[model samples]
Target chain A: MGSGSGVSCAVTLNTSLTPEQRALYQDVGQINHLLDSARTIALVGLSSDRQKASFFVAGYLKDEGYRIVPVNPKADIILGEKVYPDVASIPFPVDIVDIFRPAQEIDGIVDQAIARKEKGIDSPAIWMQLRLVNLAAAERSLAAGLTTIVDKCVKMEHGRYRGGLHFAGMNTEIISARKRKR
Target chain B: MTHRPGPRKFGFETRMVHAGHVPDAHTGSRAVPIHLTTSYVFDSPEYAAQLFELKQYGNIYTRISNPTTAVLEERLASLEGATGALVVSSGMAAQFVALMTLLSPGDEVVASSHLYGGTVTQLKQTLLKLSIKVTLVDPHNDAAWEQAITKKTRALYGETIGNPRGSVLDLEKLSRLANVHKIPLIVDNTFATPYLCRPIEWGATIVLHSATKFIGGHGSAIAGVILDSGNFDFSRFPAIAAPSPSYHNLRFFDTFGHYGFLMKARAETVRDVGACVSPMNSFLILQGLETLSLRMDRHVGNAQQIARYLEQHEQVAWVSYAGLPSHADHALAQKYLPKGPGAVFSFGLKGEGAEVREDGKKFIESLQLFSHLANVGDVRSLVIHPASTTHQQLTEEELAACGVGPEMIRLSIGLENVEDLLWDLDQAFHALSRSIRA
Candidate 1:
């Protein structure tokens, strides 16, 4: 984000976003359902770096009692889990194929997750991360009976499901009873 | 580190005014109060013990932390997008504290040759006595940095904009080199300030300022601040990661997480060195910070006009402002400091040899508006001729290497109307030309 210039993309922020795009961006039910039930997740495009958003999210989820399988051909390991080259190469069944790729790259990742389900693998849920949206890919997965989530981070959903998502100054209580009565 | 939003989330101007402060809680005071007191009251002995032991966070001594200084620290830390900050008495002291915390005997630092004269002395002379070796390299020459590094090389140091002359730094290249060498990049951001550039955004692990300068904006107080990016992994650097014999064998990195270096500097160095700022100075600097964007805007705007005026003047040989298209670092300036090349810049006189040095002195003496001074970043214009003043003893050849010619004059442009400043220079040049002909 600080690479090209130290300023935000103020103009590119879509104030006139289409209705469907806005709804897809704000869809918390599908995200909550996918996050609440998924025990094991395959993190697509996971970086080895601990500072990157993808790696930090994966680490947080892992600490929250979720098993994570990092999928990246660039490395052999991430967060101590053996990284698979592709989702189809995961030796065990994955309940969720969580994506951390950009918008254009989402179709290619969804194609892999859809192929896994057709070959007698567990009909996995598809989760696309923040700023990643493909309405066409999401529709195809929905038509194939695979639960689909777009433009939402799976870890943030789990955090919200447990109560609130805290980024910047925005807080959603992600915990139920962490606070005590005096 | 306390869940503050990134500077990217707020516009630069918005962050300037509201980054590290909020309205007063009890009195609902809109102004940041000057917290004047020597010590903070603790609720109980247990609370005092916890604060002392670093088990809990609260202020005990004004020397280590104060409410007024905390606002300034947070304001600057937010502006620079740093995880934490430690405000000190002066820019030199900030440099001393950061280096002291990071270096032990036998450690080494690879620094840029283009630095303030005082910094050159700090590295080349005083710091060597502590057994830390510093090898100065030309920052523009990447290979010189590589050649200077040894197994003991602990860090790399440079300024956001080089001193005396405003030579912009190639932040991307320098940062990549530091990362590859497994070292942190420390940047002295006194000249640029966060208003013009945030060094942390360009991978500077530590960013510091002579808050006495532009951060104070009025030359009202002497202060400095050290900002930690909290991005560097200290676990690989043994100085910070290793267990401390004085602190119950506790390792700072293991205990403080991302803020280990600053925690160590605050707990050990600031506590020991005792160069912390007074609450009164902190309040004054905060007032300076609140208007930094407005002041810097005019400062840059006025500097641009004066630099162009001097460039075309008959008596001027060369101008060294990064904003000028003719400068050697023009492209680097556009990349790193797009908000304008800042207020302070230098230019050289036209004559050669002994006559050149004489005209430089005459020009300075003839200026009616610009005050001859030892400082920069003042509300009023300032002029200094190094050949006749600061570097008077150095020969022409020696002065050239340090970005100064015997005929060079440095200017710190102020917020006054441009016409007045240009008129003052014109009359000075008239006096200079008459003396030259006679």
Candidate 2:
């Protein structure tokens, strides 16, 4: 699962000593690298709610230099970006199609991604937020030469990679350990 | 406390009432009295050794097991169609022990993306720290599950019906995938009590219940149970079968035979981690389980009636309950839960109009009968504005990923008279109308 680049190779070795560990590290590392490289992410279901993870994570990623496109039917604008009703109507090349819909609706999203590719839009990477993976669609994206990251949180990943621990405002290590102790 | 004739074998409901209890043998009291005592007296060193060495299954300490709690465990195990059960302090503890026994650091768990918010947090945040990676996939799409599994994958997890949104999972497909991969399928059957849908019959290897919900039939208890079907072959999972530095070189599969996973979880995970359910809570949950079948029947009926009522309401924008034919997963629900979809659901208000606040918080505040709270699985209807509450911690993008909108109100339907419930909703809607007009 390691990328051809030496950076992933080094991180893979340093973090994961076992073969299984190496695969997981490499898979997540490659996805993060892709996220870092991509300039624009079209977030399907990006809400206008300030308290939402989508709102905060998009805000954070926008600060990190990626353009955030809010694709919600309800909002006129989110994070200063005009909200598009769907991916098909976004009217721009989308580098990544980050979905916030349920797993059951992912097949439709994959179809939209493929349609975008057919229309000469760059076959964007497909990233499902935590607890939001569509395996069939993920495979279709993979077959179409698009990258896929599923069942992982974009906010948590940003925190993991950008050295921003405690993004959720709770100390993970101490809290979980104390929880285990109790 | 010597094994004691295995608590008078009886039918499931009867045992639920009386098992692990014997009229307080000393006190001659009929009820299964709560033994709040933390420590127990040892008959002798030889007897203690026999208990520790698995020579006998008796109460050595409260942390391991208790008489009052054992009845709940036995009853739940019987009801869930499993050989044995472990009652933990909380639903999270049950999940933690189940995963810890099945997975080691660096192993993987393939789970549905549709899960409770706490579980999603646990898998993505807490479990990630332990180096046990989780792969989220659409459990409805069997291929996605198959693709997510690598050699390192250990288990598959899903809720019978998703929390908040009430999307039904394709348990049969997930179970088949787990079998093909030689991994156990663990179904969190909290939303659908055993009376509604039993995952064991559908190929789930283990079942977990947040007894705080329907199992308790009341909101008083916060406990969880893990039921081992004793179906999945642990010999297939070498990591679990092999000796560990954690325990005194005791291979769980070799020592516990069919109940290896449950035994290891009790001895290693529960003993070391110490998340034992209180005897009092166990007693409370047992009382609830007695009326589980009856309560769930009413819960399903009330939820169906309310979902229909909400669907027809003028003020509601969208209703996402599987019982509603318009729900995207309605067909899947028909397949997995033919009887009826469980009680929880989500609906969005008409927040786009100029009269309504763009955030949709007003509609939630307008609800009268629905208590606004962070918890779910209550006998009384519950409501929350996700953008403001349950998922407030999530980013805007994350909230969308979870299908939660600022204007969305998640409702956990309770077992109230449908007519009265609707009257309350009518008044709430009328209030919203007044507020909008004003």
Candidate 3:
């Protein structure tokens, strides 16, 4: 029988992510920091349908006090906010540009975010929704000194860190035997 | 270890100790700290609104969710391989919330006849007040269970190991039956904790535990937990699938998907009814959960010895422990509870009618080391005459239905040395024999 002190491995226990992958994706402390400091989020591909994941996430982020800048070409307005056609078209600065678009469209989005960063229109960090990842696009974003997070849900990370995910009992991937103190 | 890309699964013991919590991020403390506040501070009015609307996850009031209790919920969910878990004030509260959440007026439930006495009353009597009907059927009889279901039947309920009766549920057979009928199977796993069986793995959509029992093995706290497997498609269940007027016509199933049932159970039922668990009780249960596997091992070992001893004893009529090969459910127990059929079991005292009742009481009163009490699953050995104590509320017919006869004496074998427990039982039986002669 093994001791209950927890596994000695240096990787996260909940998921089978490798050490390097864990540092990249499962460093929830970093995600928590990002969620804490970032304010406005430009939600690319925010859908008008209430059933869509993007719409739910956008609405959730808006409720969490983050200003949601909807970036969808199909709609003039979504979630009660005026929608931008693209990242470059958005006039005001956004702290994070969360993508809900397909993986094939990520390279173009990253290029636009880089152009906006150079022009000082927006130096927004890039976040891809769960199951939408583009390694090449992430590399380009990182090269432009933009923090690039892939395949993670921004609303989920916010809920996980703020102590809300337990309300419905979703595994937050945080493994520890000790409790948190206020 | 080979590198993997998805979430790494921890062993059961590892999960029991660390699955739900991380160290105090601010204080660097390695132990679970009790957050005793009645509520939490929100970032703003908007944030509070988000919490109330269920758009965001965070604490608002202790009556709804507490950080300390959340840890317990998470740890138990992890151990049970469930998608999520909710903790309530007591074992009965867990059963009530789960049933009330799923069943509406006119809906029906088919449950095991072999169950804790209070549960039978709650199902047969109290739920009738809501117009929700329940049919009691033999747990091992699949055909009876099938015949009991009708168009009104929404959920099938049974214990993994029947309380006091010690009959093991055929989880797979019932789950299959539930699936064929497009209903959910809810199981009470108080007797077989995750260490022995995970009902969810066998297709139970919802699993319940009286944490007041083995999960809080030391009997230091009273609590209950309900876990959702997140495997059931509730798109047809009206309570979950249909829009609710209570929350602006929000459809829990359409919105939360896999987590719909639990989210409704917490946000709607638990929020309104207010049978929430105390953070102190949750903390005490967490302490018990840490050593659960180790304690269960010794508990089973002691129980197995006692069951065998009682089976051959001159004063003992029959032992109903599934761990004993003579038990009617012994084969089923081996399939579901290979480790052992838990620490609690019942044995009948030798005699008939009034004489047997006297023997049962005398035997309990004469026990020197074992504490005679109504509760079970404690570190210290406990004994109870269910006909006179726990099951006293039931009529003679109901008593026989749940297998609690007047001669039945229940023993919750604990973590004491086997020889000492055997000695305690021997002395008690000897004292009972002398009293009968006198």
Error of model 2, residue B379, in angstroms: 1.9
Clashing pairs in 3: A14-B8, A15-B7, A15-B8, A16-B6, A16-B7, A16-B8, A164-B57, A164-B58, A176-B21
Task: Return the lDDT, model 3, position A71.
Answer: 91
RMSD, one per candidate, in order: 10.7, 26.3, 5.4
DockQ agreement of candidate 2 with the native complex = 0.01
Candidate 2 residue A48 C-alpha distance from true site, Å:
69
Off by over 4 Å in 3: A1-56, A63-67, A71-75, A84-154, A161-163, A177-182, B1-7
lDDT of 3 by residue, A44-151 (tens): 988897656577788898876789999988899897899899998988889999998899999999999999989978688899876577878987898898888776
Q: What C-alpha lDDT, on a 0 to 100 scale, does residue B294 get in candidate 3?
A: 96
Q: Candidate 1 vs candidate 3: which has greater DockQ?
A: 3
List, in the given order, the native-contact fraction of each candidate: 0.01, 0.00, 0.48
Candidate achieving the largest lDDT: 3
Residue-by-residue lDDT tens digits, candidate 1, B1-438: 587432234566676776545443345455677889999898778667645755444578888888678777767876787766889999999999999999998899999877776777788678999998998887788889999989999999999888778888888888998999989999999888898888888988999889988888788899989988877889878878988776666677755556678878888888899998998998898888888889889999999999999999987899999999999999999999999888888999987888787777788889999999877888799999765665554445445656777777899999899999999999999998788778
Docking class for candidate 3: acceptable
Cα lDDT tens digits for candidate 2, B301-418 = 9988988998998888889999889998899888877878888888878765333434356656666778888777788988876666666666565555566666677888888778
Output the worst ten-in-a-row residue range by lDDT, candidate 1 chain B. Answer: B20-29
Cα lDDT for residue B104, model 1?
Answer: 93
User: Which candidate should be chosen as best, given TM-score against the real structure?
Assistant: 3
